[model samples]
Target: MSGEWLAEVVQTLQGLGLNYAFVLNPGERGAFIRGMGVTLQLCLLTVPCSLLAGVVLAALLTSGRPWLERPARALVEVTRNTPTLVQLYCAFLVVNMLITQRFQLHGQTNPLTPFVWVVVVVSLHKGVFHAEALRAGIEAVPRTTLEAARSLGFSRRQLLLQVELPLALRFALPSLVNNLVDLVKMTAVASAIAVGDVTYESIMIWSQRDNVLELLLLILLWFGLLTWGVSVLGRRLEAHLRMPGYGQ
Candidate 1:
């Protein structure tokens, strides 16, 4: 029975081409594209920004004044403890409401582009995790290595940029890529805020076709393909960046 159901679902999908979907107005393909565009845009923008934030925060945590360090640590703790969905709602919905009510902002309450909002939210959220990951990576780089570089008359900046960060990144890249894949998956939540990502489009299609099962299967396939691709790519990158003697 399950096999039959799966076969039927596959057949239905094969028969449902993009044009057919459009003609039937099933899933609002256009809307789905709009959403996917927003989602991808968010991820692309957020990833780099979040990485920079992570680097800065990690440096602060590892090398700053006690006062600065404690607050950065607290920020990571708070963000990690809270649910991401709640964070999105707070940043997008609740804060928008307050901004409108208190500030009397004239335009759309959530004035930023969906891409920008999602990116900012993702950056701040992922920043905490990445900071911890990076800090661990930085720590893994031996004190002896830094001392050796200094003994060679390398300046503070050179020791960090030339010796430390490059080595740390090799250790950090795998986790960072893993986080990136997770971030891409998390973009689905943006749909709740009307950000029009792939998942949102899938839901729209499901609504129109009344083929919830089929559309959902496609959604699964889409995400699965994306995540698998990311995994493969990460592996290649890790292999490429493997320190000559380190991995051995």
Candidate 2:
């Protein structure tokens, strides 16, 4: 469609209070802000948690114990093989139900809030993929580097912290950013559990206004802006972290 038509649609929607932030209703505007906040909060929470879990899982997968390593590998494979939506649903409905019922905590406050559960599940699901990325990066690090660190009296922790992880992280940075971008988009699934995220709020607004196109456009704009900004920032940070000896 043409820019003029798009602008006209946006204008008409704004005039009819179909836009995300309806000026006529303070409550609707507040809800929109809250939803945006929730989306941001989910992304921020999930990214770090997923990255950390991925690193730990990668370490476990690479370790010497056959049982632990095999199981870790299997878990990663299973998680990667499963569809994310099914995983989210099963994790939310079935696993969550089992946990609540098994603990006899039905009457008690749920330990996992809707927001927390969204972050936790998304992080863990993405963590599987990230684990593979990190594991590959770790393996790509030269064995000579580890031996060099050992010969220099570096402890295991020091070797990992100073030598392995840094180099591995550099190699994994682009993939990690890609994973984070996916994680941000996946936050839309939070709407399924009534998390009051952007998508949920947009749906509610559109239901009342009967302006599906307007609401959807706003959603697209918001997501596009957010993801684009994130990509730009990631690229800049990646360049800043580039190793002098490493080729682009």
Candidate 3:
């Protein structure tokens, strides 16, 4: 009985000209799984790298030194102002070319890989937002806290790292999580550079089978699931870090 139903369903799908069988094929599945792996790798690597870069940039911007602050501010401004796709192109084509040229001068011709360039551009692009969030978080720290730290003879470094950053992170976490979700979606742009992420592989498969609609729906489902997971995790973290008796 179940076999008859399954056969009818397959026949109906065939009559509709939908080739889900292509998606189930071993080669196609492998390509998609590999692409997903690359996407995940990009997300995993970009999240921490961007966060660290953002923290450093935020610290520089708040350092009270014109020399450090100006350049950091400029970087954040330019990155935020530019489109991410353009940044990826410039990093992969122009910056990588320059670096390769310089290396070639020393008889070393090491070109940047597409994966590296994508990770770098995406991280830097998202890092600008993280920097602003962290900066706001830092400023949100009460002045009395800084005074207390100073009274305890904590050095400037200790005051910033120990006293300020931890509290700033909690304040900035919601924004940070939002940025991470954006970063995961932005990984789709890596396909433009032939990094073989999910979007790229999907394109390849759909091109061969002319199953663009099915592939697109699958893509949407995959990204939806990924972003949904990130949101759930962020909420849990926010709850865990909520200050007792505050924001009640």
Candidate 4:
């Protein structure tokens, strides 16, 4: 019964003149699925790593020491203002070129491949945005809360760690989720460097099959599902973390 339904669906799609049979073919199916795995790997690695980077940046920005804040602020501003793709290209083409020159490895094309470049570049870019959002959340932390923590002899570090960051994260959850959604979409750019993500795989198949519309539709649906899952998860987390009195 299941096989019959699956066949019918495939037939209906084929009837529309789609070359989606690529999905049914073993070798092509493997490539496309591998592309999806690469995309998923990017999202999984980047989301948490970027969040961690954001926390570090936010701490530096709010630490009240110009020595620390100035440099961190400059980094954040530069990352936020630039295009991620350009950054990816520079890191891959320019920096990777330098690395290759310095270390002449026989069988390697630099330790940093397109995957590493995408992860680092995307994480830093999204991290700056996350930091700015968290800074706002940190500022919105109640003055009374700070005073209470200080009255209890909490050191500045302790206050930030125990009091401010927790509340700030709660405040910034929505923005963080939105950034994550954007970051997932941003992973598509990995294809530009031949990382062979889902987008890249789709391009390969369509270029060969000349079924651009079919592949394009699949790409959109693929990304749409990923972003939708992220959105749902974020909303659920926001609800679970809702403070009793803060919103009220």
Which stretches of model 3 miss by more than 4 angstroms? Answer: 1-17, 105-111
- Error (Å) of candidate 2 at residue 5 is 21
TM-score of 4: 0.93
Model 2 Cα lDDT, one tens digit per residue, 156-188: 668767887888888998998888788888888
- State the C-alpha lDDT per candidate: 0.75, 0.82, 0.90, 0.91
Candidate that beats the other on TM-score, 1 or 3, i.e. the better one: 3
User: Taking the tens digit of each residue's C-alpha lDDT, what string does model 4 give over 76-176?
Assistant: 98888889988889889999888988767565556777898899999999999999999999999999999999999999999999999999999999999
**Can you give the lDDT of residue 144 in candidate 2?**
92
Error of 1 at 25 (Å): 3.5
lDDT of 3 by residue, 98-215 (tens): 8889998999867678999998899999999999999999999999999999999999899999988989989999999999999989989999999999999999998998988877
Per-model TM-score on C-alpha atoms: 0.82, 0.87, 0.92, 0.93
TM-score of 1: 0.82
Better of 1 and 4 by lDDT: 4
Residue 106 error, candidate 2, Å: 8.6
Clashing pairs in 1: 27-204, 27-205, 35-196, 35-197
Off by over 4 Å in 4: 1-8, 105-109
**Alpha-carbon error at 115 in model 1, in Å?**
3.3
Query: Which pairs of residues clash in candidate 4, taking residues 3 or more apart in a chain or in different chains?
Result: none
